[model samples]
Target: MTTPPDWSKEEKAVQAVQMAFDLSNDIQRAFRVSAALQDMSTSDMVRKVLQLPYQKNRARPRLTITLKDEDFELLAEKYGLDPLDRATIRHRVSEDLRAFAGNYLTES
Candidate 1:
């Protein structure tokens, strides 16, 4: 607004109306924000808005118990487990295989 008031009266009126509209929007936002703060502190709103990170629970180690065909079939019957041969087991449950070998293997 440092520029001279050289414009005609209509432009001045339009500028005043736009400033009024901006002020109204700011006032309305302030009221809504004030009401929310009255119900709960601003810190509470921030904490709720910014979610805390999720923490993972510690899980027990997995073990592989190889079952004989009949026993495996019995396990399959009892727990509804699909039969898995050693090679298939090695491929499917690769994570447990190393731990199982580590626990039972003789060092070469």
Candidate 2:
């Protein structure tokens, strides 16, 4: 990920900063739709939206996991995750895994 430019009072008030992003077409389309729906410039919308998780004091990191279909289904059911939604699956699994790790650490 690219580092965001500093937005300080001392910095010059530039109308916009151009940066190239290597995002998937689907993501680009989604951002465009969201910007249109909110009646805002795409750049402004993207900046505001991207700041949300940071504002919440949440860390955004990438993780990859491989599981058999049956295993995934079982975990999804146990965690009340929707199998059709990959985002929900990932969120549920991350939450459950973190909880498990915490419990294990405490018990140890």
Candidate 3:
């Protein structure tokens, strides 16, 4: 018997849209471990958790924040993130804000 061929990379990529979502720190860590084990992205895991349609496209807006070099370094240290990479810093801040929003909604 012959094994089927794997999907093309483009085919796989087009099956889902990439977007960001937040989990609690503990939950985020757990999902990170699970995603690593499965060799999947955390965004895909979040899609599973939210039961979003696999092929749907959602608008994702960008946010910009400006900070002094010293202030940026302080935030990086506080969040335990790398200060040199803007994308990583933004992603970390987005995750933290999402978690905060979730908590706020739950408590209100």
Provide the clashing-pair count of each candidate structure.
0, 0, 0
On TM-score, the leading prediction is 3
Cα displacement (Å) at residue 86, model 3: 1.7
Candidate 2 lDDT tens digits, 1-108:
999876874365565456889999999999888865665556656777877322222133334578877877887787777666667787778887788869756553
Question: In candidate 3, what are the lDDT values of residues 1-108, reduced to their tens digit?
Answer: 998888788797899566565658998898878755555565655666679643233234344577888866887898887778767877777888788869756553
lDDT minimum window of 10 residues, candidate 2: 52-61
Per-model CA lDDT versus the true structure:
0.51, 0.69, 0.69
- Model 2 misplaced stretches (Cα beyond 4 Å): 1-17, 52-108
**List of clashing residue pairs for candidate 3:** none
Q: Which ten-residue region of model 1 has the weakest summed lDDT? A: 52-61
Ranking by TM-score: 3, 2, 1
TM-score of each: 0.18, 0.33, 0.35
Off by over 4 Å in 3: 1-64, 106-108
> What shift in Å separates residue 27 of candidate 2 from its native position after superposition?
0.3
